[model samples]
Target: MALMTKLKHVDLLADGSLRYRRRIPLVAQEAVGKKVFQQRLQSKEGADLIKEYAEIESLYEQMVAQRLVRARKEALWGNTPRETFKAAKVSSESVWEGVRGLDRDDPEDRHLVAASLKDEGVKKLILNPNKTEPKPTLKDALKLYRKERVKDDAAMETRITRVWSEVEEAIGDLPLDELKRENARKVRDHMISVEKYGGGNRSAATVKRMLNVVKAVVSFGLVEFDLGDKTNPFIGLKVDDQGDREDTKRLPLPDDLTERLRASLRGDLAHIMTILDETGARVGEIVGLEGADLFLDHETPYIHIRPNTTRRLKTDSSNRMVPLTDAAQKSFKAALKEAETGGPIWPQYSRPRGSDSASAALMKNLRKLTKDRKFTIHSLRHRFKDRCRDVGMPKNIQDQLLGHSSVDVGERVYGSPEAKLRLAAQWIEKLT
Candidate 1:
């Protein structure tokens, strides 16, 4: 089966079929488990046999490359006996002979090869055919950040992802270890100078917040990767004297405006308004609801506020159960009739910016009802808090029901969920 004009390491089997054969290096034999790696060449043609030889040879080369890198790392760690694992014995020919002719037809393969080249540069000449990569950039750390910190409207996701976009623009995706204090300052100045809305520059407050997000992301990475010795460039920078003001916060909706708005709501808007009035859930949280999040068959009906694939809750504390009032019960019953089990109750807004879309629609309706900007859709949440306070609901109970920040209402003291449901239903009835 061997052609006389053919490649090295090609052999004829006893059955007269062609085969490719090679010896596995001693260091990698433990991982691969054989002295020689041989595979039958299915093709009997001359050109095809040579092609199969290269393909088989490349696989062997890849294994050798990985074993050599690991052996080098082990020697450096002083974990392996030096003479038994000599990386210096690795021949020049073994480093990515296959990679040189790697299929450029594959997009991911080409991209990874290029990206690896950018990191190592001219000083480190070899491509890692083993597919090992070194160190994460701020962009890389963003992936880790997303796993740990999910927030409203994907707030952590939005703000943090934006930080990486800015990082990529300014610094070319510098590794986390190389991110110096100067680099953070560069990003801050870049943010300040950019015109986010028309000709108007990004506000000092906006810049400060971006820096805070950057700090949070970097701090998260340092702790997670155990790179505490690395300097965090985003921390304690002097971008300010203009701090947040409490007066700018959304006010409770006036009673007359609430009554007028209640009268105006119709169709899907009516259902959303009724749920907001009864439960004080965020507009986004309501629109992003899946049918499973609602419990109607129980003795007391309630809406569970939590995160989903498309929507992110502001914090873990945002997840709580709100017992429905009579109006909410009617509205949700209608939604359940139309919605699929475990599917979105309001499919229109169950997406990446679904809440923002819902906000625009709500605000457009609110603008027609009132000229005042102070009484926005979010005032419903404030009004709910005020209503609870006026009805003399225990502060802890109010906090627990509304998902406001409170140290404890004592989960043990709250007892079973049925007890909590009965307790919440009693208080929510007063809001009606």
Candidate 2:
């Protein structure tokens, strides 16, 4: 009797050759254990009969070639039959062993190397597999960061780009995630020690700016990892005069100095500076004025201070009217006389012609006249607030004249039409 009972024929392709196979049933463990087994045959005649019908080892070379073409088509469309075959052979040494024995210079063998790595699960090997490397080529980082910020906030995006550029220049080959606090501190210290400015050594301000970049990236990383309540390493880090950086030094110039500075200035620069000193309007609002902003004919001459470039106002409160002083009214009248168009009242002080020309000819001219003075052109704005206080201008009226929103009274009840009229009237009376 034969214990070997042959089952249905199966087919397989090997090296562009096809061959048939047959299975003999056995217990699973024994099948796994045995390379070959002895079988008790029914008779010698039966054994011989089974061998005769087995077709020896017939190879279908043509069928195997056709199957290769079909498999290639499937692979191109992402079915990837070849990869599946390699994956299915993970436990089998002979399949990959044969792959290794191929010509070392062959491109196909290089692909086989990649497949080998994939088969071993290379993705599970890294500490921060999902996190991107800082060493991503400059081109790649730009594309990724740009794609991330679609809102086109130019100021914010510029800062991010600038910081990345600094980091890239400092460390060329290292990835961003590999950066440590020690290295970041080194960079900060280097910037503080080595960097130069218009003054002496680069101030703590410059150091703080560079550290801010490192902190931003780390914070972004922490958020990505869902880490809770992590403090940034850059937070407590300090350079020289660190406490002094917090002091904004916002105070008014003395009355005598303010008057001298005003008289020393000429043209739009003089007028603009004068108006800023009188009204406490921001430089942006003063420079961005249009003829329509001034209402000189009204009972109280006033100008609406809006925060806008070419498009629209920045905020609702920024759209309110501010009373103009006598000096401001005189400047506005002079600006109107010189205006070629009604768009911007102060036309001479319009947008820049060029970087060098604008800075040297325009800004430098003003700086030359005020060089001996203690006050900045911006200090005039501070003086306006101080003068308003000196003259016993009500806080609410002063805030209204400065086009500032009423924080004390709250928005709901402040800056009514009556309040605006009263403030504007008081401003006119004082100016007159």
Candidate 3:
């Protein structure tokens, strides 16, 4: 605001020329990286010099604003100027200012300018015009999602990775924002072209799971990048589940089959099946047990189902103690001899995809043992529930024993592991 003559911050030089000068705001001095802006004016003529002075002053105003915006962004998001633009975190005004200085003849600059002009939000994404990296693609989205969602379930990891890889291949790894509804449809159609999971052409259920993988990644990326929810191209996507008509529902193992399999199984599978049937624990939970997880010497013999290096529990509630049945105790004692003291009880099936490998092997045998497809290894878990419910066990206690979240949160989550184990032992002992 220093005015020597008629114009503000315009200094009349000793050599009879006009100079444009101004001190930067105190708060913004560090961000601007200078105490003041001083420029020797090129125009010495009457009205031209005044116009030149005005233009120089306006440019400095913009420079200060741009620098302050960058400082705020760095403070808030910890991103530098170039990273802010790349991440779509820069303001439109800042982007426009940065792009304004670029030479349009340069191919790189021309592309950025063209892209900004073409976009509805003008200059919004033109942060660093000199450095335009590839757009974030679907595969990138999946990689980021997997990194955040840590899971030791090797089977699911393998399955989901393949599902996303198939989508990426079908869609040529399209950028997340560039992914269209048609691209999702194409992926859905491509997945349904096979009959792998079930007999007779591909199932509608199969296509839905495939599409869900795409939806999950896209949704996760949109949120992670602070893109609006509606921007997720895969939202509201639908896949028809009207094909194949096959009964995929699992049925509880009949009492006769349960007894026969229990008696028939020997070695590790016998012990595993015993634990699965006796305590409604999932197969992954059973196979993940290290010798340390078993508390046989305690007053209430039990096994702790928890997250370990080899496997992650399905949910936080999955970490609990389940009292062992007499059959389960005997089986654990036998299985313990297979490992090195407190090491993994089932070493062969205790690593990534180990539980999956075990499941596939057990399922092959299970398929041979039963005529019905519904009576798979998982049916043993159902039989355990049926047995628990049949013996008049409280639904809350049943949910605790099964590692399932319950409607009665107090009953399911409000006890010491010992107290819970004692209660579980009392009810589970009632089971045959």
Candidate 4:
């Protein structure tokens, strides 16, 4: 014979009979002394056992409800002394008279009366039944969501602040429930338009990212605040094609411009640009580097790119050791000499502001050498990749050197880190 499945909150006894087992609510337990509330049901069979369990469960709820009622009543009337009641201008007799007016036969009425007595706001609503509950505004919801969910996440917190700021500017503080698809579309249009919230016209990707944050905020509010039955207005929203712009596909700088930029750049900013040009590391990765991350003494000199308290790598693949070229070694050595006592290699830009600060400093000097807006600090990474491709380096080897995850499963899963380092070192040496 097949064994019967156990029901929730119902346990099987030693004799194979089901028992109704549930812990009483803490409030009820406190009001009425803690005692065994569980009982063995009469039925032993599956269907009959479930039926009996339901009936027992209902009785258990009623028992707890009665205890709660008593506790609330005591809190409201019995606990308050006559002197305290007089101070509040509330008479003991008047409170009892109001209680007596509530229908004793109706459980709902009793619950409402007890709830109103406990809460001043609820009591006011009870007295004036026509008064409506205030719905939380989008700004309120976003603030609560940030506190509960994204407070610890710097990137998420920044994105939420930016997205919500835009939404607030376009449409004033509206109720979260009142935000519909039409409002979302309007926000999207405003973001894409040249009318700056802060930055100039937002690209499609930016608009999409902002909308995604809005959706996440709405979704978080629904679940976090018990508003799941409500609709998420930001969901399934789309940005127009006109908003879409391709990512920067900057070409390698001409030899003269590159040389001029290298000569014009100075100090820590100069070293940062040199490192980017030589290693193809992201600006954030280079700026966030610590002294310990440099392994120049090792047989193969490399920089370990990893997450720190200040910032994180773009992806897991970004957490890798990049072997340094001759030019990169020189830059790294210069950077190490100026390293903080025990902190990051570039301490000047080590805090949360590192990446932006470093980029701005570098760009300011770079603009003097080259008029081309396309020749950004990031273009060095592109140039490195282009050089690797030009030299006939294997795609997997290129991916490893650049901290990009390989699309090929064989290379991703089976390729050894040592093998990758060897190939990458050889290819990077060729670029020098």
- Choose the strongest candidate by TM-score: 4
Which candidate would rank higher by TM-score, 2 or 3? 3
Computed on alpha carbons, the lDDT of every model, listed in order, comes to 0.67, 0.50, 0.69, 0.68
lDDT of 4 by residue, 1-432 (tens): 022254556677788776677788776788867754788878766555544654565456546655655564344222122223333334323443567656644657646664647545444434444444466666656767767887688655545654665686677667667777888788877777643221224456667877888788778877766778888878888776542333433567666776788776556666888898888888999988887787888778888898876578888888887899888899888878867644788765565434765676566657767656556766788888888888898988888878899899888888677777776788778887
Error of 1 at 35 (Å): 62
By lDDT, the better pick of 2 and 4 is: 4
Off by over 4 Å in 1: 1-137, 140-159, 166-213, 216-230, 238-243, 260-266, 307-312, 367-373, 408-414
Best by lDDT: 3
* Each model's backbone clash number: 0, 6, 0, 0
Every model's TM-score: 0.57, 0.52, 0.61, 0.64
- For residues 25-62, what per-residue lDDT tens digits would candidate 2 score against the true structure? 23222323432222222222343434322222111212
> Arrange candidates by TM-score, highest first: which order?
4, 3, 1, 2
lDDT of 4: 0.68
lDDT of 4 at 77: 26
After TM-score superposition, the amount by which residue 256's alpha carbon in candidate 3 deviates from its true location, in angstroms, is 2.5
Better of 2 and 4 by TM-score: 4
How far does residue 153 in candidate 2 sit from its true spot (Å)?
3.5
